[model samples]
Target: MTDLTIRARIREASNATFLADLDGEAVVYKPVEGERPLWDFPDGTLAGREVAAFLVSEAFGWSVVPPTWLGDGPFGPGMVQRWQDIDPEQDAVDIVAPDVAEAPDSGWLPVLEAIDEHEQPVTLVHEDTEQLRRMAVFDTVVNNADRKGGHVLAMPDGHRYGVDHGLTFHVEHKLRTVLWGWIGEPLTPDELEGVDRVSEALRGDLGRALEEHLTPQEIDTLGARCAALRAVGIFPPPPGHGPAVPWPLF
Candidate 1:
């Protein structure tokens, strides 16, 4: 076990978040005691949910979410995750509101159009990349409730990392995200294979690991989602009633 030590506090987060060192490695720490209570999720369970997201990502053989684990920190028990340094110059996912008459050529997918502060129309756009598509698939399987654009981290090496996965794995459906570009698209053969791997893992080791963090019902529902997605073989559309997109998208 690595010895984790708090180095600094991250003030930008809604809840208490810390920057720490684990066995000489830099990591972000989110203590359960510092988590704000949510009406939907049980009290002090957000940290566990974050780790659960990591476990699911690893199971899929998709390193979309950063490496995370449950451990003791300066603030008590919490989730510790390896820090990913994002490239400042380029963003894998970005918002573009070009003032041109017609939309730009290709590579971008329009998410929504809104009126700017100047009353001019603006269009929100994200890159059409395989990395982002994988993340969207991961979000669906994990039942990620909050997938704001800001949560996507673009590495200098072209790899994308996702963070802040505290709201996930609800027994009831809850998948709020900004990645609607691939909605209704058929899952690739590799993606389907990943889903199958997860389904099998959930019946064994992954299930046991999650049981320590989540309720039995939540784990069961997670397996059911895997089966349903495999059966459908298509990216699902947002539910009819609730909000499918997250607020403050970036």
Candidate 2:
């Protein structure tokens, strides 16, 4: 922990998060000791879930999530992830009023609409990019319950990185996200191949690695989700039972 020094407190987070200089490299650290109790996820498990998400992203070869792991920090044991310096001028997801007229064309997908501060209509939109599609697939596999607009980071090199995965990989079907644009679209050859690779990995090493951080039941569900996605060969919409989108999207 002495190797990592807190550079700043990430006040936007619900739990205590800090930007730490780990041996001169910047990393976002989420301390498990600072976690707030959740009704669903077991106590002190969110940090593990964040690392699990990173593992899944790496195993699937989607590379949607940044490198992350469980580690010791100034606040104690928690998740530490590589800090992605996103382009401030651009966001992969946004909320734009319908009358804004100047919104970008072609690559944008309006996932849902809501009322703005003035009680006017606004639409929640995300870019229709291959990177985002891979992210959506990864979210389905991990059953990410909190994929807000802010979680999708647009990097300087044009790669999109997904962060804030503390609410993921529950045994239940809890895949709420802002990335519903590709629902009902047929999966590409590369996407199908990615699913196959993840399914196989889950049977062996991936499953074993996840066991350290997740319950057996949750790991089983991850395998099941991968198999189902491979069988369908298409991006499926949210199931009828639960809410499909996260609130306070940004």
Candidate 3:
């Protein structure tokens, strides 16, 4: 659906969430509070979080969750979004085992590893590593600050999808995530094509419409990321360094 076409009723949600029902379908919402421990962060973090997820999803032509509406919030009126039905067991695929610790590579590990809560296991099995790498690219493009191990999900059919984008789009370059499989590797030809399609889409009406919701700096940064990815021909080296990987999956 178009970004503007998603309709959901805004209900009362906790600081971490803005509750809403998507088109009278299942429940759909986004966390209102950007990320916990907000002392050192940026503005519009809450909105930026959801927007970043949607932007990345659209750019890559995936079913990325979108913010449906806007309403009054603890900080003020913010965007409303459709909530994803995360089956605790089914959704998570990359989280590593916690109690038993790191065993053989037969299980999923936490791909997004910095979340405050514990709901899924994040591990890096041999099969899921490549998908994790692709997700890392999407995270970098959006500047998502919180790509915890548990945020990456495995659909029943084994397709991986990234979620929980509440900390994104800071003025700073604080891109953190757990998928380090491609740190030194280059982008594949198909991956490069995906980046080009996204870049082209951004320059069209989609980017102009998104500009209304995103700040000038944020929008420009999005463009810059697309351009950079197209030219890099490879993943390139990590620019700023804090931690390329996320926290412990287990």
Candidate 4:
């Protein structure tokens, strides 16, 4: 692995994150030593989860996550992912006033309604696009527990990329996310095919690759999630026991 030179710290991130120069390209580096222990997730495993998510995204062939790998950085071993240059004018997911959400040409699907600061009504919505729908399916297969709106990067050419995947791949059901707009909708053929590809890959090389990052049980559960999606052929409904979406939606 090439040495990553620290450029700056990403203070907004919950875990210790940094912007670093890997060769001549910019990348986001989250060192294992900087990980905060979570009661549910094993300590120092968040970096591995990020790498695992990237591998699964690649297997799906959707580019939902940027290129990511586990490598040694200035701080120590960590997850390094290519940095995305997002478009400021576009938002794949957003919070908008009810009237904007109600517009027929708005091209957004309302997921939730709530009062904003100043006691105003607002709707949590995301664009009705195939890219986002693919991401939703990817999240489901990985059992992502923290898919915040801010995590979806809207690129200049309109490609959507997701980040912050530390909370994922639990042995149990823990799918909490903001991309519930397609709940109960039948899966498109392309989406189903992607799931099928992942399911098949899990039985061979992909499964072996993930063993470096995930436990045997977690990997098994991941395969089961893929099978369940293939069986249902629909976007899954949110969990009945826990909160359906992550807080601070944006």
How many clashes does each candidate structure show, in the order listed?
0, 0, 30, 0
Write down the TM-score for model 4.
Answer: 0.98
- Compose the digit string of candidate 3's lDDT tens values, residues 135-248: 767777777767765667665555676765666656567776655545556887767777777778778865776665667787778778878777776665547668755544
lDDT of 2: 0.87
How far residue 160's Cα lies from its native spot in candidate 4, in Å, is 0.3
Identify the leading candidate in terms of lDDT: 4
Clashing pairs in 2: none
- Candidate 4 residue-wise lDDT, 1-250, digit = tens: 5568999999999999999998899999999999999999973399999999999998999999999999998889999999999999999999899999999899999999999888999999999999999999999999999999999999999899999999999998899889999999999999999999999999998999999999999999999999999999999898689899997687
From the highest lDDT down, the ranking of the candidates is 4, 2, 1, 3
Best by TM-score: 4
Model 3 — which ten-residue stretch has the worst lDDT?
A: 1-10
Error of 4 at 30 (Å): 0.5
Model 1 CA RMSD to the hidden true structure, in angstroms: 1.9
What C-alpha lDDT, on a 0 to 100 scale, does residue 250 get in candidate 2? 80
Model 3 sits at a Cα RMSD from the real structure of 6.3
Q: Which segments of model 1 are wrong by more than 4 Å?
A: 98-105
Clashes in candidate 1: how many?
A: 0
Residue 215 CA displacement from its true place in model 3, Å: 1.7
- TM-score ranking, best first: 4, 2, 1, 3
Please report how far candidate 2 places residue 55 from its true position, in Å: 0.8
Per-model TM-score on C-alpha atoms: 0.94, 0.95, 0.68, 0.98
Summarize candidate 2's per-residue lDDT along 11-79 as a digit string, tens digits: 999999999999889999999898999999873388898988888888879789999998998779989
